[model samples]
Target: MLTLTEKPRRSPKNEQLNSCASSFADYEDCIVGFMDDLQLVHCGHDKKCLGCGEELAHLTLRGVLRGSVGVIGESRLAMTEKVVLLGGRVCAVKRFRQVSSGRREFGKKIEHLARVSQKCEYLVPVAAYLYAKRIKQHGHTALDWNQRLTIIVQIARGIGFIHEQYPPYEKKMQMNVHGNIKVCNVMVNTDFSACLSGYGFTQLAEPVEVLNTGQLMKSPCRQQENTTYSDELSQKSDIYNFGVILLDILAGPKGLEMTKGVKEKKASMKLEGGLEFFEFYVKEGKERRQVSKVLEIALACISTKPDARPSIEEICFNIVEIL
Candidate 1:
């Protein structure tokens, strides 16, 4: 398998892991704006923001699994909705399980991750996370198909952005690759665009919460029924993760089973076999062809051989072609 030494075909600019974006809020739009706009531009952060100066406090949380669930190494997780008093934007605050690190360490890590992740749009910039132990419960579709296309494409671009990062980033942040790329980690906006979250903190941040909006319900990137998280990860693993997400998009209720079948040699990764599951989404013959192409792309992503797996850059280009 080719290691970190391999260069991307995306171009000389991608060599530096650059793409168009002045800020993280505008990243989804930036994905649409460029592949041509590949240049590592520094995203500016507020120098005096309180979030940037984090202070950690330990919480002995015994979570109620009814409204939320996730394994955070020691404890269970619960979900609560948060409203930013300043902007009135609804944000979900899910309290995490057992934390092994000191409060100060956790705070520093969040600040560091936020500061470094600003270089790109697809890799979501941290929007001030609060470590409130959730004492309460928590909280798409397109016009319709176009939004589906938009969300997936943005996710692909985001993953592609991660794959193209310079080595210095991984050294600085401790995680350059997205260790977890599950359905819940991809946040959809009110505008139907999407961004990848839960990155860089394979060891620290337990993505116990899922940010929801109208686009999430019908969006292909809905939360998985039996979600799993891991820390021992790689770029190829990310391809597999993304493939499973694509499978979920196409197969819905049968996604997990189909993924198992494909992995365990029980299922065929043929277009005809996959098409039956997603038939409702394809209205016209052209749309069917696009879906077919996407299914193939997903299969390639989950290929068993590490070398056989397509890079995120390749996947992004192919997905863009389908759109």
Candidate 2:
């Protein structure tokens, strides 16, 4: 088995060599050549094992489970369902293809995710991740009340893990931002535990120019370009996205759409009787109060002022208290 470790930074000459490599075989040659020169640790073989040449090669493509669904969203990547044989077990894969650029950066993002996931179980475990002409993928596979409370708390813990960045994992700074967070990005395992997947892909992808739209939007606080808090991807922004996820959970699928329409209106205090629209759904007693508390936390998360939003730790605490 190939041991996965961080790749050494390429020298300018190596970069040029890599840029000139025309095919996957040529690129592998470049890497092998570099590794041989430095006597860098590698699978003990004169001819590098092509199967495990890349850091994530252990999860090799076993068979195509499904076909491509053309380019999707800002990632500008195609998706395919496939089956990968890893550790003698079959795992479902979500293969990705980047359009023109950012492949290297995306690979680093995956490396960072893989490292973090090793330490944080709340993150979606990467069975394998690789980058080439286009990125490829591999990996494996939640909800209710006491179930509702359990779901949100687990979600918060996952987000908090991303935010905290403790110890060895902190060596690589890029792992800090979960640039994309949404209902679709949050996956529930068969065991009902929530794990976050889509992380740095949004940042690597082509940036969308339009403001305040879509499932993942720029936090209102960072809308202005010149502000110190202008980075669209930040801990606070993750919190804001988490808030949206909470709202989506509270409201069903159709209700989530309605909530989005009302979001702008709600921010401006223009929604007729305020949050009563959401409150109307729950019974008027303790259930309404409990739901209202959760809503308040959600609203705080999506606050226009990033400073006003609670940290992930605080969000977790509040949710735990409510439960």
lDDT tens string, model 1, 1-323? Answer: 00011111245555442321111221233235344433221123543222334221211011111112222111122222232322222222333333435665665666666665666665666544333221001112123556666767888888877777666353335455787677766666656667776676555544344445322222222334244433346888888888877766666535545655554442333434444455245665667667667777877877778789898888888887877
For this target, which candidate reaches the highest lDDT against the unseen true structure? 1
How far out, in Å, is residue 234 in model 1?
Answer: 1.1
Model 1 residue runs over 4 Å out of place are 1-44, 47-94, 128-143, 168-173, 205-231, 259-275
TM-score, structure 2 vs. true? 0.55
Error of 1 at 174 (Å): 3.3
Candidate 2 stretches with Cα past 4 Å from truth are 1-80, 84-89, 99-109, 128-144, 166-173, 203-231, 253-287
Error of 2 at 175 (Å): 2.0
lDDT by residue (tens digit), candidate 2, 1-323: 11112123357765433221121221233244343222222222232332243433332211121212121222222222223332333332333333223545445555555556657666665542222111001111013334455557777888888787754234234466777666655655444556666555554444324433433222221221222122377888888877776665665433334655655565443223234445233454555556667867887887789999999888888777766
Alpha carbon lDDT of each predicted model: 0.51, 0.48
**Lowest lDDT block of 10, candidate 1:** 58-67
> What are the TM-scores, per candidate, against the unseen true structure?
0.59, 0.55
